[model samples]
Target: MIVVISGLIFYFVIRRIRKQIDEMAEVLEDIKNGNGNRRILSETHEIVAPLAYEMNDIITSYENRLSAFRETEENNRQLMTSLSHDVRTPLTTLIGYLDAAQKGIVTGRDKDDYIETARRKAHDLKDYIDVLFDWFKLNSDEFAITMNQVEAVELTRDILIDWIPIFEDKQIDYSIDIPEQPFRVNLDSDAYLRILNNLIQNVISHSHADKIGISLSKQNDKIAILVRDNGIGIGKEDLKHIFERLYKCDKGRSEKGSGLGLSIAYQLVEKMHGSITAESEQGRGTVFQVLFPLAD
Candidate 1:
């Protein structure tokens, strides 16, 4: 009688184990069929509980990575579409003006004007192409950054000096306050210059602001640089995506160029161990602040 009882207990345990295996197989099959949300569950006392929890974690991680990849792929597609439109428009204009000028469609000052327009368009196209190249290079694996310790206050002041003439030419008022004190930072000078240039260029191109202010100061162990403009400010929705590649605000800003300037700036700043942010209110203007860690 005892032998028979032991046999029955062993048989029941084997049957329960078989049922759990079958259930796990079905759940795994469903997951394999693209139901990433599916998860296997088991009681804490069950032998397979740990395996089930581990599988769930693995599936969640994989799904998250896949979702991110899909998002990046979609963004690249949109960028290509934007590239097509932005390139073709200026290119077509440039060719038409050149052709008309060559065919003598207008004479004297009119011919000169056509040639001038063609020249300007050619330059504009070159600028757009340059931005495109930068965007591609930045996204590629080979982009390199050289970092060195430098007195950033003097360097920043020197950079702004070159922009003074441009501001006057654009009829934009400027107030720059860079403390004569020096602060050390590890940065790529060329990259830093480009970052500042892109921010200022964005203001000039998109912000219809007539007044601009630049200030540099040290905050704790970080250096802060601010670019403020009294321009037609960006909307709340658009401000959130200003640093995303190929993102343009059509309602509040001019839809011009490749829309990669601010994105490139953001990436460059990050590569240099810095951060960039912006704040704006409709018709109240916008301010861009960049921060970098101060080097000892």
Candidate 2:
């Protein structure tokens, strides 16, 4: 009788162990089938408990990373789509204008004006292409700025001189207020020129202001440059998105712009280890403030 009782007890224990193993197997199979909700229901603390917890944690972390990656990818796709549409429209219009002129559809002063218009559109297209390429370089981590010690005052003067013809033609009154003392900054000359050119062109094309003001000064180990215009100021809502890629304000004037100027300028500023901000009130004009650290 004693031997029979011991045999019965051993049999019951073996049955319980087999049942637990079957349950664990079922849980793993559920997980394999994409049922992340399933978890092991262990009755007692054992080796499997730690493993179950680790598996759940790993799944959760993986899901979170995947979600973040999807969001980033969607945003990039939207940006690229928008950029393509915006860039293609102007290029198409420019081509149409050139074709008309070539076929003698335009004549006399109309021909001359049409040619000039085509040229401007061509320039606009080129500018858009340049901005798109630069943005792509920035996205791919291929764009780099070579920093060098540059005199802020002299640089400001040169930029002003280059833009004088445009200002004169537009009858736009402009003034440059630069300090007599040299203010040095660490920056890439090409990048800096591109930034200033974009900003000035934006003022001329979008501001519709008769007068533009530029000021350069040094303050507290940094150099500051301000570009201000007395024009139809940007609205509060528009101001927030002025620096976004392919963003344009005023649908009526959208045909005249590619909306890449401010975005490029903003990125170039960051590459130079500088900061840019804007202030504007509707009907009171806008001001762009750029600050760069002085080179050591």
Q: Which candidate achieves the best TM-score against the true structure?
A: 1
lDDT of 2: 0.82
Per-residue lDDT over 166-218 for candidate 2, one digit per residue giving the tens place of the 0 to 100 score: 89998999998988998778889988998898888888888889999999988
Q: Which residue runs does candidate 2 get wrong by more than 4 Å?
A: 1-72, 250-255
lDDT of each: 0.91, 0.82
TM-scores for every candidate against the unseen true structure: 0.89, 0.74
CA lDDT for candidate 1: 0.91
- Angstrom error of the Cα, residue 128, model 2: value is 1.3
User: Candidate 1 — which pairs collide?
Assistant: 209-231
lDDT tens digits, residue span 88-122, model 1 = 98899989988888998888899899999899889
Q: Could you report the Cα RMSD, in angstroms, for every candidate shown? A: 2.4, 5.7
